[model samples]
Target chain A: MLLSRMVPTGFNDLRREMDRLFQDWMPGDGNFFRPSVFPAVNVWESGDTLYAEAEIPGVTMEDIEVSVVGDELSIKGTRKPMPEGDYTFHRQERGTGEFCRFVTLPMPVNAEKVEAVLKDGVLSITLPKAEEAKPKKINVRTS
Target chain B: MTTATAVEKREGKVRPEPTRGGRIYSPNVDILENREELLLLADVPGARPEDINIQYENGELTIHARVDSRTEVGEAQFLACEYGVGDFHRSFQLGESIDNSKIHAKVKDGVLTVHLPKTEAVKPRKIAVKTA
Candidate 1:
C-alpha cells in the first residue's frame, strides 16, 4: 500500500530505495507482503508531471530495456551471477534471474514524448501530458 | 550466551568459534509493493552477481552478500569510510500464490530487484453468469 505513494522525485527515490534495501535485515522475519526489491514501482500524478519509477538495483543502463505499448509499460533485464569462488558458508542470499515485468496504466500515457532516465539504480520515466490531456488555456477579455 | 561448533573429544567440551574465516553474505534488502507487484530493491555495493545469493523459504525471501576485500583497487587513500563492507543478510515473506518458482531477480547499480510474479489464477478474474 505504501509503495504506491512513493513519488520518484530525484533523490526522494534514492531514500525510498535505501529504506527498501536496508529494512530487511533491520527486522526479524515474517513480512512477506513487502514491496518489490526491483519488480515493483510507484506512480503518481502531480501538477503537470505523471511520474513512474522502477526499482532495478545492481543493473546498469545498458542491461535494461524499457518501452511503452499503448498504456502498458514493460521492463526486461538480466542479472549476472557473482564470480566469487568457493568459501565457507555462513549465510547466502540474493536473487538472480531474467526479469520481465509489465504494468498497464488505468489511463493512457503520453508515449510519443515519453522520457526515461536511470539514476542510483532506479529507472524513472516521465510521461508527458498529451495535447488532449493538457488543460486548455482560455483567453478571457472583459466583454 | 555461549555457542558451540564442535564437541570436544577429551572432556566433552563444546567447540569454540570454529568457523572463523569470512564468506559471502546476503546484503540488507527492503521491498515496497504497489497494486501490481512488490518492489525489491536491495543495497549491495561492491558485490558482483557471483558474490550474492538469494533463496525463498516458507513465505520469506532471503539475500546474502560475500565481501571480497582481498583485492584492493589501490587508487585513493582511505580517509572517511561509511559504507558497509562485511557480509550482509536480508529476507521477505511472500504470499501463498506468489508463484515462488517463477520469482525473478536482478541487480543494477547496487540495488537488487526480485520480481514476484503474481499467479494469474489468484488474481481477480471476471466471470459472467448467464441464464437462459
Candidate 2:
C-alpha cells in the first residue's frame, strides 16, 4: 500500500505549492515562503513503528504538550514573547503565540507504547503499530 | 522613548557557496539592537551544538549549521513530509564595528542567540549636563 495514499495531510500540499510560488516571485528573503502553520511536521513509517517529527524552536519541554487519542495525534504549544527589555527590533521574523496541530495516523497504533522526545528544538514521536495493524504473513501447507 | 522602524525582512541573505551535497536551507532570524549591543536570534532545529559554526570577518557574520539526515536512505516510507531536513546557512552584514572579544553566543531549544557588542566608539553615550 502506498504511504501517501494512506495518510492524509489536509491542505499541507496546497500550502507547500503556494509557498513555492511566493519563493519564485520573491527570492532571497526566507520569510516569504513560511507556511501559515506553526511548527511544520513530517510523518513517516518504518517497520512496526510510525514516526512523527516537528520543528518547534525556542520552545521548552514544559511549554509544549503532546497527546495521542486512538488514531489521532495532537501537538500544542506556546512560544512566549521575548523578555521585557529596552531594545529596538530591526528584523522580527520568528513568530510567538499559541499553536495547535492535529495529525491523523494512517493506521491504528499502540497508544500505550507511544514515546516522544524533544532534542535540539525538534520533537520526535514514535508510535508503535497495534497488534492488529501489523502485517501478518500466512504460511501455506501442501495438501 | 523607544522607536521602531518598519519591520524589514531583508536581514540575512543566503550565500552562494555550494554545500557538501544535499539541500541547504536559510534559517529565519531576528535582529535587535540597543544602546550597548545588537542581538541576533536564529532558529536552526535538528542541528547539534558541535555542528554549528559562526564566523565574523570583513564586517559580515556567517552562521552555518550541519544537520544529519533523520532517516536512512530509502528506509522509511514518508506519509506526510512538510519540511525538508538539511543544513542551515546564512550571513548578515554588520554596519557598525563590533567588539569581537566580547561577542557571545548560545543555543537552546534549537534557537541560537548571538550577542554582538558594539565597539566603545559606536555605542550610544549619554552626555552629562552641569549648571554653570
For every model in order, what is the number of clashing pairs? 47, 0
Candidate 1 achieves a global lDDT of 0.53
Q: What are the per-residue Cα lDDT tens digits for candidate 1 across A1-143? A: 11211221233335545655776786643233334444565565554546666655556777889898887878888755443333222212345667777766645778987888876555677776566666778999999
If scored against the real structure, what TM-score would every candidate get? 0.42, 0.84
lDDT digits (tens) for residues B1-132 of candidate 1: 000111011111112121345433333444443333444656665556676778776655667655454223443232212122345454444545567778888765766667666667765566899998
For model 1, the stretches where C-alpha displacement exceeds 4 angstroms are A1-31, A35-38, A137-143, B1-108, B111-132
Best by lDDT: 2
- Name the docking class for model 2: medium
State each model's CA lDDT, in order. Answer: 0.53, 0.77
Predicted structure with the largest DockQ when compared to the true one: 2
